[model samples]
Target chain A: MKILSKLRASIAVAAVLILSAVMFVDINDAQAEYGDVVINNYSDGAGMRPVVFPHWFHRVRFRCKVCHADLGFKFQAGGNEINMVKIIDGQFCGACHNGDIAWSVENCNLCHSGKPGTPTQVHESTVQKLAQPSGAKK
Target chain B: MPVSTFRAEFLDTVSGLARGAASPGLALFLWLLCVGAAWAGEWLPLANDGIHDPRSRAVKILQQPREALQGLTPDHAGNQVRWVQVLEKGEIRPREKLFPQTVVQKLDLDVILDAKGGMPAVRFPHRPHTEWLDCVNCHDGLFAKSVGQSKISMFKILQGEQCGVCHGAVAFPLTECARCHSIPRPGQSKPVIPAGIDPRIHQAIGQGQK
Candidate 1:
């Protein structure tokens, strides 16, 4: 009777763990789209949430030259060293996010709306849907 | 002091020392070299430094283009550089983040532009370009997502507009016609141009007028 009770308790614990895992996955998958980039290089360590950059959102208003050419952002994800310091200094996201062009950086939640522990990377959905390039950097 | 004025005054002072041990002209040359290096250090920062300062240590060496672009795949024509092949072969991998991490998300879509007047269709492959670029690089400004949106013409291109923005300048020169005008149109359906295609391609080829 005692052994059976122990086995039942373990099974109950395992079920809860599995259910929570599924719920956790569902939370991360909540609102991401094709070109959403999750940046968590410093967020987890800094005790803050990761940043999810929406590429299509910015593409609507500005030309590529505004950011990629004029602003000098590289093609690679997490390629540019974007920090709170740099953003505050009227460079990168700061150029537009500085009150006049768009919302000011004072609104932290506007950009840092990402999962807690997501790693820094170009979102997989954007690449996986498309075929990998012939001689892409590994 | 102004460079020209300083040069004139220095030369006047050193004219007496021209026949002396230090070869005054050579000393002036060395001084000018120092000045140039100082300016470069201030303006052109190290690659590891500022984000905009793109100068690399390897690129700073005297023998450049020849030395910097060593050991890469060669192309048969059009600037003689098969960049896709070199990147595929992994001659160099750019860092997405510092300490050598790289991520290249490529899309595999091809947009074909139908040419009129017995011309072959132009196939714009997204793979090679998207391999090194983000979608924002071209969309909404350079070329709209919708077909027939941008007015692309050979005349505009020759004048450094449309595709000419990169092709003639950074990418292969526009002289290589076969590279872009690759796809042959299928027979006899009146060769309808796609909705999003730049109409100038058909107009220019059909009328033989750019």
Candidate 2:
């Protein structure tokens, strides 16, 4: 009887451990994907959701020089003063987003898809897994 | 002359003035355009002067890469184009400066990151980067003037600091391991190597590890 009770206890402990591990991974996945910059510079202040700038999407189609060199975008998150006025004035994002290059700024939900009150920065996970050089892992 | 002809003549003269002079003339031209737009106080559906036509430019960008990047090595991640290889082979000659007035100075240097216990050391070449970007874009901000001044780890890099400023974002993804961690570790196939390895062997095999 004692052996059966101990076996039940161990199984319960194992199940809880597995559940926690899955929850942790799900939380991390909920945070943000790699190379995604959440721009909350003025979005929250102006009463809108933070803009989730997917660096991968843009970089896949366009070269870095196209934006960094020609458009003069500094290489940092929350660095550029990107606002609707500047965008509409054909300045920063307006360079290409003037209803021709890809999509007009009229589509609001596409870029500003981040959760409310999220901070502006690159969305790298706070968890530094391994905390050592894992540069070899592809 | 007709009103249309007179307007065309005025635009031509202003554009010619803008071309002859520097930034101030360009500013004036933009100011005038803005003033004209404000005066109109309305939008044009098929605008000629106000809006830019991206039809030709978009087509060129889409079509040019196919021929230009032909026969080049493909990358595993990010843009899927080996940009460093592309620049090294002179596949594309991108303008360093937007204005073209300020001459860009190219620099060449070898930044050898030491080999880890398992992984090969990273050999960061400066020539390809300098050919594309200015020195100040990284110096004193991302990396210091000399090596060992900054502590570079995979931890900070994955967090989008240091080299992460470009890599894993715009330049290239972190998946391409062999591209950066290229310098092989010393003595891959050891014939009973010593625990305290000789510096001479390191100098010979690793080349710059010392």
Candidate 3:
């Protein structure tokens, strides 16, 4: 009778532990699976201070075939060898910047000039000047 | 008083005490019954078959993209899958390479080609058909490579191109758009963009008729 009582008590404890473990795994799996791939890279690749690639800004105008096919850019970065000198030449950024699609070297300030947070300043000044009346009468 | 009457009364009292002791046994039995009930409550125990375990079942069911998409429906037991462009090779005018009832599936290249283009997810159903065929039926010589440059186009589709090489004639009719792009419920959204106005809306509009 004592042995039977012990067996029953052990089974009850085992059942409770099993249920709790299963629920814990279910929650953990959900969080891990849905976690962001891009977010992981931010921490892992933080040392590089990676180049800012604003996706929504550029993608609105260009087709995938233009940069991917014509310019020969691989899907993932570091997949292709990119050199700044090559971009200055008629290779990557220079493809359209030969004074056709967008501004040329004359407008170098558009990209390489502004420091972080300074781009907004330039836009703000332009808006301020536009709102002001010209000193010289029309 | 007689000694026999005293003994009879004593025996009746002992029987009453025995009944009282059995109540604890009954309570323990009830507690065990509750535990057994709790064990059965989890669906995993009921779902596990002898051949394939529940985890294995989730894996097996998830492997087929169609099964994952269609979900575990009663209609899934039937031989026919609702949506898919079925292609069979060499059954039509361009009877050059491949065989009849060859499956030609179209994978979405939007995400692969451009990061910003977003994932134009494909709706592939290989289970119901794979039951009848093999891998070579679709892949053939042009097995795996970067998409889009493989030369499959609208023209090719009309002339039985990549997938058209089969679906246009043998497996199922090409006129059936709903076969692949099934009529979604109202407000069904594309996978690539959010519920709000798509940023690519401007690009897609710009490319119109140009």
Candidate 4:
């Protein structure tokens, strides 16, 4: 009976240890996936789908100062009060998406698609590509 | 048993042991065992000092505020002295020479919020903030470009959401309530923008137009 009680106590301690380990791993995973920002300020109110701006895609091409400083894009999503009128007038996103610089604003589905799509796969490939040494790639 | 019930029973057992009905050393050992297991997991530190550490070089400048003000050029010194006077004498004098000519081509605009309840209205000066940081630092990130667009509350600021991001950390501690709420104070005067500043800068900042 004494031996059996000792074994049960040991099992209880082991179970607590394993449970805490699993919880910690889950918390770390959540922190790693916090990069995505969803912009839904006026889309739902205006009877249109909200736009999802992927930071990884643009971050790879341009520095933060380019869009934030020169272009005057706000840091928070939906903080700019951007509308279709401002875009056509060549204001916020219009500065780059005006057909000449980047993809034209005519491609609405590119941003407003709202599907998960291939962002995870694209981000992984981009990270791998950028991780390689500069001269070694050529 | 449910986790809460188990926890209550375990705590009662520990307390009973602590009261000398059972082995006190054994109860302490059990408490340490539970706490040590939780501590072993990877977790964020309870306190992250970041740039706000009092021992840091940046914060050391605040110890001798006037000496730090004198370090700048004569023209620039006047601009910062007004802030120092606001801190020490509780005087709200008109801010002169708000910004450097080369950095930005606009005159400074003061944002005056109406007093809510009995609290003084917040007078946010653009020149002083713009001097240290670019427009993008606050715009769209901490504050929306268009006024009344951002849903600002004292609770949000205390949580380090908007103004709290910099106020309590690097710039100045938020304990100085009157520094921001300067509207109702006696002898408060409107800030004077220096002459020769291009009027277009105000238009650019206000409406996002060239």
Which candidate has the top score in TM-score?
2
- CA deviation > 4 Å runs, candidate 4: A1-15, A24-35, A115-138, B1-210
Top candidate when judged by DockQ against the true structure: 2
| Candidate number 2, chain A TM-score | 0.70
Candidate 4 recovers a fraction of native contacts equal to 0.01
Candidate 1: tens digits of C-alpha lDDT, residues A1-138: 987786566556555554554454322222232244667777668876667675434533443445675577765557687889999998888977899878889877657655566566544231322233665531
Regarding TM-score, does 1 or 4 come out ahead?
A: 1
lDDT of 2 by residue, B9-81 (tens): 6577677776676444343544466345333322122112111122223222222223333344444333335
Error of 1 at B78 (Å): 5.8
Cα RMSDs of all predictions?
A: 29.5, 23.7, 28.5, 21.1
Mind listing the fnat for each candidate? Answer: 0.01, 0.05, 0.00, 0.01
Per-candidate iRMS values, in order, are: 27.6, 22.0, 23.7, 17.6
Candidate 2: segments with Cα more than 4 A from true spot: A1-32, A124-138, B1-111, B115-119, B126-136, B139-141, B144-160, B168-179, B189-210
Better of 2 and 4 by DockQ: 2
Better of 2 and 3 by DockQ: 2
Q: Which ten residues in a row have the lowest lDDT in candidate 4 chain A?
A: A26-35
Q: Which stretches of candidate 1 lie over 4 Å from their true place?
A: A1-138, B1-63, B76-79, B97-105, B186-210
lDDT of 2 at A32: 34
Per-residue lDDT over B1-210 for candidate 1, one digit per residue giving the tens place of the 0 to 100 score: 223454456555554454452433344444444444333222121122211112322223212232333244443222234555655566545422211233335689888877655556778888777755556677876899877677677677765567865565345555545567666567733344457756533332232111
lDDT of 4 by residue, B53-74 (tens): 2223323322222222333211
lDDT of 4 at B183: 63
Candidates sorted by lDDT, descending order?
Answer: 2, 1, 4, 3
Docking class for candidate 3: incorrect
What is candidate 2's lDDT per residue for A1-138, written digit by digit as tens? 987786566556555554554454322223233455778899888877777675544543555556675677887778998999999998877887888876789877566656666666654322222232565220
